[model samples]
Target chain A: MKPETKTTSFDLAFYDRMAAVLNAWKHLGEIPLDKIPPHGMMEEITRLLYLESRLIDQRRLREWLDLFAADGAYWIPADVDYRDPRRTIAWEFNDRRRLEERVERLETGQAYSQIPPTRTVHLLSNIEGMLADDGLLHVLCNFHIPAQRGQDHQARSGWCGYIFRKENKHWKIVLKRVNLFDADQPQSNLSFTL
Target chain B: MTTYSDHLPSLDHQPYQHLFKPGFVHRRLYIDEDIFQQELLYLYGRTWLYIAHESEIANPNDFITRRVGGRPLIISRHATGSIHAFFNRCTHRGAIVCREPRGNTKGFICGYHAWTFNITGECTSVPLRQGYGKSFNLAQASLQPVARLESYRGFIFASYSKDVPSLTEHLGAAARLIDQWLDRGEKEPVVVQNGAMPFLVNANWKTIYDNAGDGYHPPFSHESMLKVFSNRYGDVDMNYYGSDFDKSPMYSKNLGNGHTFLDQRPEMHKLSAWKRQHVMPGYEVMENALIEKYGEAHALPMLDASTGSGMNLNIFPNLLIIGNQIQMPEPLAANKTLLTWFATSREGVPEEINAIRMRMQEDFPSFGEVDDSANFEACQEGMASIPEMAWIDIRRHQDTKVGALDPADQLWREPMSSDLHMRTYWQRWQELMNAGATRALVEAGVA
Candidate 1:
């Protein structure tokens, strides 16, 4: 599905305030950490993406299961109004249990496609969004995962790989959608988690 | 007009005994430029190459632009509800007029001097009326068509040569290849829901084509896959990855036309019970439909979980299909070929069904086991650069019965089971290459 192509340019002051929150929120001196909410949240966001992207790109699969909460879900919608999960086709959807099972199978090394794991380097930028009605940060960010194995090099842009609501302080991935410009065409097999 | 011999070694001259004897194919078929060019004519050109589906370009002015066998062509839905395909290039300077891969255009406009054509390939607009003076005739300048364009249950294909047979006639034994997958949809237009094959390899294009038909490589190359499937299914022997399974390594190499269904045996379905327990509900309905059409016995056998069809299906030279309805598993290969996947359902099927299909695609096909295994083939960088030993052998099922269900049957399944398919492909290819430029494909299809 084509993602919301909003030109979300914020004011320079908005950038400054966010930067200040990010910087000041860090702790090094004193007895312990201070202003931990903002910095910790940023750290968590970066960590969450890096961690999830690692499992998917590395095909670490089993290790990947450790990251998701029991009730957590993975989604990649095929259409725009994907906000309502009931309406569209998502590339993947697994509750924690199913995800764990898949990972376990991957661990036993039954996965044929992963004899050589998928190598990936993700570039994340333009992070923005607000706290949703659910209290989880409604995070919106753009990431490009350029992956290669042996001689094949391909890129899966996250105009569609979405990271949805995260509840409480615990980072639970509510949704991850990937929309490729070439999504409507014929494809080879895609064994890894995007 | 380079005859196959004029170029280098000729197919007629090469002793074809290996093709008849050794079930294994020589690697030369993979790396040979001569074979690749010949296929562009003998196979890709003459065959009913899959071009586009009706769902993709539905309305007037709606068009899907793509390259067909080395030529720039556009498949468009005309205002009259008919679909047409024509060269996308302008007849004048030969510049491609339409830039977007797809769109609803108000008559395509060429940036080079603004030569314009309608969605029907009719020349619509040109610069100043006096530009070419009296010598020019606009009526004589309409866009040239592909000569023969036809659709089979919405599968659009075009042939450049006027002498070719009907699309159905060209399909021949090949029709079964399309039927295996298309039949799954119960005669509906097999909607390709945003599926894409995105990997590029350094090897010759035919290398990939022949590999698609090879049934032997999966166990040795994809033992990991077998291991993964075993783990997923709770089977511990891993013997399925070895030669212990009933069909052993040969069943996977058994699809006709150099296409094989590795797990097409009882051992394959015995392994799938675990998957049957895990799959979405829609699969049952789809499976039931297949059972009814193909018969309960044939259909049930396919569900053995071990019976997954090879969606990594080889559609002749350059196309592969994702086997069945759900289309999940893994990114078949991310780097070896350019992958694009469409999550298709009956155009009017419930939205939730589409969603489930989409989810499955992410977990498997577009990012599935097929892609990863294929990617490793590319990394064997060792496979390509070694001594002139470029010829990999497909002699595994050399005896026609080696690939056949019963050795008594005279008809061998060719490249998939016997070397007959490759030999046929190569020999027919030789005929076209020997004919040279007048053969249309070698002359016109080549840039």
Candidate 2:
């Protein structure tokens, strides 16, 4: 969908500064290259990303809930790499109850777009380091999403931001953020999770 | 699959294409090189082809590379805050200067000769200033700007020829649909909801357009989705396919102007009270945008109206405006018959809500194995007939003139049919196709 008119103008100056900061975040893979990401953290984060992709791709969906915090959320913006979720619309938004319902509905009954669950291989790369002020370690990564369900070869690039805190000696996801490169661009059907 | 290479290369045969009419379309329109070439000139040349939106290039030096027909185009924001789109080919050599989908670049430097141009498409530097001798002036060659570029509501459009009607005029009657979609209250601006889900379909591009505003496909075509929704909510959510099924319904409407829409949104939301809440936000800024643009009461009802999510409407040629769902719903876009969906949102609801919305959006039968089945079934079925079919029917609603279009009705002049909308599209197509080459759109009849 193309714009009908320019009704919303973002803070251009701030957007530029943010874009630069985001770009610098891309090169951050250089930092932890010498030392492998901590195994436990890596395992935990990898599981989150993997579990997220699995629900939508493999359709295991029912198990998706085990991962999220009660207040956890999911977002797919209308525009590519959309920075502020407040400004644009999202394709999906779910709290814990809603999220569970989605999986339950997909499993027990007929899901429209699920004639086949999406097949996806999310390449998580560009890991960056950020220790939050709130005693939480936030790991950032750029996700190269290449998916194929039917004829469409869905390839997307996104920046992932996750806030993790140690819970019971294991990394528990506090907040997981995904900013798609084309976040602000208009979209078609995204019947599955990203 | 054979359709990929089954093209007929000659444009000459297109003149009397109505003659050999063995089936649906004269192969030339689909497989002919001449028709493709003409499309670049007539259709894309003078039409307000969609480019990137303002949000995509929000800052100076920000750039995105997209394709217009087969030609590469560059969309960028200059320091002056003006957005510009031009052919991506560098003047030095016919090469795509920008390869990345998006970036922030000060200027374009051709890898071949290093001819540099700033945001204005001006030649700022060249690798060998002395190589051209005194005869080569840098000002003579710069990035060529599109003949006409304008954007309405952040959506950027460009045309190779300036003679076509103004963007508003070109949008003609269809602009109302855009307005209705965004008006919330009449003062609101519809912000980008979710990123686009661009997928490729094996079928022709027209299939998606033909199906988008269709009311006939849901019960059976999207049975899985309908069944799923029905199973969960105990109803298909469609007035037509729900508990009350109308096998043969009235369809095809002429919205007077070229613009039109199918009556599906009303039924989808009617499935349940929960679905109604799923339709609109508790109170949205989009409503405020509408109130600011139109009025408060207008914005409230329009945006708050309970409706099914998929209200896919298209602006002739390309550019389709689809549903703005509150949950994990995405919009389906057709790129020359290839189907991809974008998960859209109204902008910054809660992440938790967006996640559920994304799940609902992406975890559907459409994106799963069934999309291939759904689209392929349509394409294979539509094209199965002999190539010589006579005048494709657009007469679905011609019999009963009224609201709510039925996809079963595919004829022009039907009150419920958007096929009449097609009449405008065809008229525009014929005007361009008949003009032949070299006869550019001069803001009047072509050749």
Best by lDDT: 2
Docking quality band of candidate 2, CAPRI definitions: incorrect
Ten-residue stretch with the least lDDT total in model 1 chain B? B326-335
Per-residue lDDT of A84-182 in model 1, one digit per residue for the tens?
A: 333234444454544554565446554555556567776777654444334444455677878775445787665523334554546766544455444
Global lDDT of each candidate: 0.50, 0.52
lDDT by residue (A14-132, candidate 2, tens digit) is 22533454455445554554334566666667776666766655666555566655545444444444344333334454444445545654564455455465677767776655544
Q: How accurate is candidate 1 locally (lDDT)?
A: 0.50
Please report how far candidate 2 places residue B135 from its true position, in Å. 3.1
In candidate 1, what are the lDDT values of residues B1-447, reduced to their tens digit?
A: 222333332223332335333334455444445655555655455544566777778777798777666667788888789998888899879999788778887578888988788888888767895878988888667788887888866667677765556666655444555665565423445465354333333435544545554444545554543555444444432334465333343333233333332223234334453243334323444454556666866655444322233344444444455434321111122113332334455454434334444444444432244644464455345454575654555554444443444353333442323333344444444444444433443345542
lDDT of 2 by residue, B322-437 (tens): 55531111112222333335444434333333323343454442323244335544453455344663344444433444434335543233332234444444544555555434
Instruction: Report the TM-score for the A-chain of model 1.
Output: 0.63
**Candidate 1: regions farther than 4 A off:** A1-64, A75-123, A144-169, A178-194, B1-29, B32-47, B176-189, B193-197, B234-315, B319-322, B325-343, B348-352, B361-380, B400-424, B436-447
Error of 1 at B441 (Å): 13
Real contacts retained, model 1: 0.26
List the candidate 2 regions with Cα displacement exceeding 4 Å. A1-60, A63-194, B1-16, B19-38, B55-63, B77-83, B103-106, B152-154, B192-194, B230-252, B255-259, B263-275, B279-312, B325-395, B398-427, B437-447
